[model samples]
Target chain A: MTETLTAPAPETHPRYAIEIDGVGKTYGSGDGAVTALDLVNLDVRKGEFISLLGPSGCGKTTLLRMIAGLEDPTQGSIWLPGRGLDGLGFVFQRDALVNWRTIIENVLLPLEFKGRRTKAAYQRARDLLATFGLAEFEDRNPWELSGGMRQRAAICRAMIDDPQLLLMDEPFGALDALTRDDLNFELQALWPDPEKTAVFVTHSINEAVYLSDRVVVISDKPGRIVDITEIPFERPRPLEIREEPEFGRIARHLRGVLDGHSARRA
Target chain B: MKKNPLAYIPMQVWTIVGIFAVWQACVMVLDIKPIILPPVPKVLGELFGNFGLYLRHGGHTLGNTLIAFAISVVAGVGMAIGIVYSKFLEKTLYTLLVTVNNVPKVALAPLFVIWLGTGNASKIAMGVLISIFAIVIDTVLGLRSLHPDLIDLGRAMRGSEFKVLMKLRLPNAMPSILAGMKVAISLALVGAIVGEFVAAQNGLGFVILSSQGAFRTDRVYASIIVLAAIGTALYYMMEYAEAKLIPWHESRRSHARPTAPSKPAKGPVAQPVASDAKA
Candidate 1:
């Protein structure tokens, strides 16, 4: 594990932790080319929870994948100061747990890959599982767990390494409404640790408003960022917050943005 | 109600017994010539009477089959790995393999005998040639058919290329490789038999050939029985290995039989957690 490097100038307090400048991704070439993301630029501050809220085929996932270093932008650049691949974690839309391994083994997989499977790492895995209500099911296969439990376990797997930045691509999209709500709250409770930052991608307007500090909404068809809304709700938000006037207002605004995009495209 | 364990025998077992009884009754009622269609009793008698001779020849056949199967597994898996790791090998070697596999293996039996001599070497060679392609194709398919999400997870975890292959890809491919092994084992037996048919002094194939020449239909039937038993045993052995190795696999899980029925008197069983019916 790498230590967090102190910011060079404390007075300035680096406004952006990550800088994505004019990044564009085009797939293939020569008449067969398709642009996934076009001139998308966004900056994320340290320890902020940002959601890339968009409709399908909006390049949100493609953008997330690029941030995770799984893919590279064909144009422009993305810069994360004093961060390496080891400091990043990803939670996919599907549980993505290795079917053959136990929950604890899956959680400890990143450590295993780094050849750093110490006793402390095992303890950390157990602790994370316990936190996620998966302690008793550590030895069970992924198939044996419910969808919610599996996704929770996946979250544990991602966070076990104590990544500074967590990239989640619709991590709760496959779950039922009730399970998705519970997990959204769980995620909210988990994201407050000041050292951790998160970039969440989702199609749910309510989810973006409920959990994100800011929602970056993108439009489809050579996807580009249309708006970045700053959410004013405080940390550790309660479920009742959803029923509040401000929450409804934010959700409605995001829904309008999405509906307007679709209407115009049609 | 307590049921008799004997009554729990599979339907296939009962069907086989019925077929044998019908065969015996046909020979008796029709008064068929012993030379034409020998009675089941006579075949059983020959099998039991020449038990030692049968055992020696069966051992030779089994040895040839096993040695050939082992070689095919190693070479096939090796080739699969090579093909999977290299696009050039997949394009060139895979086509050649498929073409060679399509050729009639029995036609090549005499060629193997000529090259490796009329001994265990020839039999093993025939087995390798006959069985290797299925193993290669099945294993290659398994290795390549990994779930994309799993690959992405591995990459996100920073697994090296070697680590991905060893931990993620190989284990994911095990069930397919085992399926291929089961198919290859049966083909291996056929190859050994074909080689023995071309030229051999020992083995069940040799016994059957010599008995047919001497007009001993019962011995021929006995030799065939031994061959069937060997094939069935090898197949089940492969199945048992597959069950043990990949119990997590859907095929193995679906095949698992409940040890005992739940007691209806106890009412509905309470699950510890809400089972994800949709999952």
Candidate 2:
């Protein structure tokens, strides 16, 4: 993947958090070998919420996984200079809440694994739960809650570690449209730090437009970026921004680019 | 409306009475001999008359069954953990469990008696052999059927395998494991009886055998009734524990707490007939 970003504006390199250079990932070998990503390159500025938007088999999830350190890239390197990515938190498509653990306890799981299970860690977990409107459900198991509630608890767990980077893989895809919108707003409100970097993979074009500062559109099969549209909306973007002509224009323009790529592949 | 929990007791009593009434009528109309078809009252009288004898044998058999059932639970869960932790062990051990489980456990009763003698040891072993299959099969399935996503989540959170088992797999599998134990309890009871039939000095199975040899059919049936009660009680106790431990599980929660009515009717016009018609 070759990156040819025209002229680098000062805003473009915010903090130069992640530099993906010519990463190619291939699975299996011989008849079974599948090239999921081919010649992929991208740069994520610090504190920016970037959405890797693509169709199925486009290696969007693979790219997100590589950034999260869940999968090693076959060719390129992923570096998190500031705070080190070993402390990165991930929110999965499924809630991934341990069914046996209560909501608060599930949120505290990262601390337990990291051997930082002090009383203060627990207090922080409870504080996070309260922020998410889950104080009353702190003692409730995952199965006892509704799907939306479970996903809320999942977000709390993901943020429990308070890492510099948060990797999300279609976190709100399984939710209903109404719940998904509510969560999107909730996420924007509780993003921890304005300068905290986030890499999200999603199939929904609208979700990409709503949650991301830059939407990285990718092609199918040998996944490679076709376009990176920078969203110019102001900070603390309210749901009302969706009705603005600029937001609609960018969204439509990205859709047209995606359509063209699909046409070429066909 | 609240469902009266007591409703089923009266239904059960009526069903039992109907069965006896049909039996009594058949015996009287057919003029069957008392030896062939003793009256229900006579059977009950014999059961109470020989209560001590029945209790002694019943206690022996129930003790053996309980012993076997307990061993099965421990061994099954242990084996399940072993198989899940290692793929090679699972492949080899699970194949053996399946093969042994498929073999009719009753066929092994005589061998057990020969090896362990005509004592409680053989009877307990026989029962264990019968019930172990259920525990192993269910526990393995429960352990292996955990969602892959949950495992990945645990790994992402940097959990050790031991922690994952303790915090996730074991608790998630509780309902299924309890279900398997309930099924095994009945089989364990049956196995004890079969062991007694093969060779035993005591137990309900021996009592039934002796009564049959003497042609005392009433005593035989009475022993059977006692055995059935014991088995039912054990199964329900497991069900009760399962309901308590996994209250969040859908199957358990629905039955754990009785639901309150949505709201009481406002008027006397909301009678049974009106409600039925509306339904």
True contacts kept of each: 0.35, 0.19
- lDDT per residue as tens, model 1, A1-266: 11112213333335566677788999999999999999998889888999999989889999998887788888877766645566889998887787678889989988888788999999999999999777788988766667788788889989988888899999988777877888899999976667888999999999998999999999988799988899998888998899999898888888888888773658
> What digit string (tens of lDDT, one per residue) describes model 2 on residues B1-279?
998886767777888778889999988899988788888888889989988988898899989999999999999899988988989878899888888878877888899988999989998898889998888777777776677667667667767788888777787677668777888899899899999999878999998899999999998888878987898789888878876776656554454343221222121111111011100
Per-residue alpha-carbon lDDT of candidate 1 for residues B1-279, written as tens digits (9 for 90 to 100): 999998989998998789889999999999999998899988999999999999999999999999999999999999999999999998999989988978887898888888999889999999999999879988888888777777788878887888888888887888788888988999999999998988999999999999999999999999988898899999999989987888767665565443232111222222211111101
Clashing pairs in 2: A1-A39, A1-A40
Least lDDT summed over 10 consecutive residues: which range in candidate 2 chain A? A1-10
Query: Which docking class does model 2 fall in?
Result: incorrect
Over the full model, what C-alpha lDDT does candidate 1 score relative to the true structure?
0.84
- Best TM-score goes to which candidate? 1
Cα shift from native, residue A201, model 1 (Å) = 0.2
Give the per-residue Cα lDDT of candidate 1 at A222.
78
For candidate 2, lDDT tens digit of each residue in A184-238? 8888775436557888889888889888889999988678889999887766768
